[model samples]
Every structure is written in structure tokens, then in C-alpha cells.
Target: MKTICGLDCCGACDRKEACGGCLKTNGRPFGGTCVAAEWMKKGGKDEFLRLKNNLIDEINSLGIENLQIADLNLLNGFYVNLEFTLPSGQSVKFLEDKNIYWGNQVEIPESDRCYGLVADDSFLLVCEYGCGGADPQIVMFQRRQAGTEIKKQNLV
Candidate 1:
């Protein structure tokens, strides 16, 4: 079992049997490109690390209380594709089910709930939810401004 980004995701993942692995599929695990692996393949580790660190800084700058993001790991889209109810009374999911993303889970200070942070090259999403992502509420959803590459500057 090999990994594109050197993370032991395949060993820890429950879907390994069905998904094979990132290395086996050339980063297209589960029929979707893994963001971390794709970035690593294109730019090597340093560039990917820079992108991850920059994204962390961008997420932290949002000023959401106690939502500091330390590190982001490769995450399956379906795992974080939480449904959010809009102010217009419509429930929606913002992420593609088969896509991969960089995300982190930050536990809100002194609370049982947690903040779920998910991002791609195009957007940043923050949501709050109870145990097991139950009763989720969208805290923030912002898209990257046009022509602003995530590696070059702030996301929004």
C-alpha cells in the first residue's frame, strides 16, 4: 500500500478495499483526484506544504472564534459533504460526492461541538456541527476571487 503524499491514509481508511489506493490509481482514488496527491505530483512536497500552510492562514484570518486550523489532511468529499439549510429554507450540499479535499476538524473551545473546515483551490467552507456531524450549521462559505490563485495570495 503506497501513498502519493506519503500519508498512511490507505492504512487508516476503511474504504481501502474498495478504493484501492492513491498510488494504485495515480491519485484518483475512488474515481476522484485527491487534492493533496495531485498537488504533490505537479509541484512536489514543498509547494503542497506551502499551499496547505497558506490555506491554514487564510482560514485562521476569517476571525471565527476558536476556529484556528493547525493542519489539513486529505479528506474524502462524501465524508465532509454535510447538508446545510439555507436562509431560504432549502437544504443543500455544497461539495461533490466523489471529489477529494483538504480539511481539518477543530474542536470549539470548551464545547462538545466542533468546527469543520473544508477547502479546495476555489473555496473555503466552515461549518459547526454536533457529534458525528449531526445538526450542522453553516458558519461561513466563501469563494476565491477570480484570478487569485490560492498559492499566490489570500483566498478571498
Candidate 2:
């Protein structure tokens, strides 16, 4: 029942339906739900393993170092947050988007952050980043079901 977020920390709260840690008046990101848990229930355990491996591979491919696993309480499934330092000496943050559609990207201008929630039929990963200015970049690595990978190419 370990759950985590891509922000290199445990989910806001231990509850699967709600998180108390990162409390934002606005509902959860994605689609007002927990995307990672949904995938776990749909694909089962084997798919989860594959999803994890794929994520690791993706991170390595990015040439990112200084990776850290965030704390995720296991309420429904294993949710985790991975924090890493990009080669460019920038920071990245990743999180789980709970929207029904896997392939969606959202940008927050106030924070200068871009988010990519990609999913295939079996897996879903939330790829987020902060660009421009002298702010450190952030990326999130969240695990979802297999074959549910979504790709968000552009962030407006």
C-alpha cells in the first residue's frame, strides 16, 4: 500500500481517494482522480512490473543522474515520485495525472511549468518540467498500468 508522487515525496495524504499532503483547493490533477491506482487495477501485477522497468529505462535514456525515490504510502497501489538532476544542472518534477485521457499536456504559466501525462494501453507516466528563467527544472516519474503510455508533445 505504498504510494508516492513524481515530485520526490509521498502523496499529500495516505487516502487513495484523496491526498492531504499537497493540498490544493483545486481537485487532483489529471481528471480529479488518482491515475496510478486506476492502471494497477486494470492491468494487475505483471503489467506493473513492466511499467516500472520501462520508467527506469526512460529515465536512464534521458541521461539524468541523482535520482531519488519519493515516499508513497501504499493505499491502493504503489505510487512513487522520482527526483533527478538533468545533465544541464536543472531540476525536474513528475506527478500522476488522473484524467481519463492518458495523452494530455497542461502548462502552468504562474510557475513556468509544463506537464505531460502520457499513457499507452498498459502504462501512464506524468512528465512535468519547469522551463525559462533561472528557476530549476523539475520532472516527475509516476508509475501506471502497462500499455497506457500517453505522450504530450507540446505545452501551451
Candidate 3:
């Protein structure tokens, strides 16, 4: 596939035949471990999927009626957000809690659902909740270009 910055390394890498691709190689096409790839490799995608799916379930349970996909943010726990506009025209925001035990909830004002997406890129998250009004939905996506430099660290 492509690097985090969206470089078509598979097409240009001389070892594509042996390596398969960066996604498969964990971004270590030539050598050295890529931290970001490592994070995703070591159960990160699974965690992300769990959170995303859980969000869909929680939203559907709200029964808020006609809640439309107003906005979404897929940041790590510290910055996750999902917003919906209620039938009443008020906004509803679901924010991720820093406390691992607490999970997410509808708390912030609907107007606060303004976190930006990647603008132009493939959608990684596509969720459709059964809100029973105009098919409320949220699509979270990201566009990675060769210039989209990425850095990964242990954090701890």
C-alpha cells in the first residue's frame, strides 16, 4: 500500500515482491522498525475498531431521533469526538474520556462538534446508527500525502 504520508512505496520499492508492502512490513520496507507501524501492528487497529464500533452502538441506543452526522474526530482517547445534530436543531457531542474506565458520552454542545477531518482522503471509519430519521451517519477519514510527516513514540 502506501506510507503514512501516502507515498506509493509498493509501486516504487525495489523489494515489493519480497516485502509485499509497507502495511505488511509495518513500514519497515528496507530496515528499522517504524514506531507508528509498530503501534498499529501491536493491536492498535483492533483497539480502534472496538472503540469505533462501540460508538455506533452507543449512538443507536440514544434514540435521539433524526440525529444527523454533524462531525467526528478520531483522535486517540485524549481527543476523540463524535457529534450529531438532534431533530430539535440542537447539537450533541460525544467526547472520549481520559479515564479509561469511563468510556464516551453525549456531553458537549452540538455547536462544539467542529473538529476537522482529513478533508480529502480515504474513509477509515463508516458508521450507520439506526436513529430512524434520514439515516444518521458518520464517516471518519484521512488523507495521507508524501508530505504528511508522521512521528511515533512510546508516550510512556
- The best candidate by lDDT is 1
Candidate 3 stretches with Cα past 4 Å from truth are 1-43, 68-71, 75-156
Per-candidate Cα lDDT values, in order, are 0.83, 0.40, 0.37
For each candidate, what TM-score against the reference? 0.88, 0.33, 0.23
Task: Decide which is better by lDDT, 2 or 3.
Answer: 2
Q: Sorted on lDDT, highest at the top, how do the candidates line up?
A: 1, 2, 3
| Best TM-score among the predictions, by candidate number | 1
How much is 22 displaced in model 2, in angstroms? 16
Error of 1 at 16 (Å): 0.9
Q: How many angstroms is residue 27 displaced in model 2 relative to the true structure, after the best TM-score fit?
A: 14
Q: What C-alpha root-mean-square deviation, in Å, does candidate 1 show against the real structure?
A: 4.6
* Model 3 TM-score on a 0 to 1 scale: 0.23
**Ten contiguous residues minimizing lDDT sum, candidate 1:** 147-156
What residue runs in model 1 are displaced by over 4 Å at the alpha carbon?
145-156
lDDT of 2: 0.40
Steric clash pairs (candidate 1): none
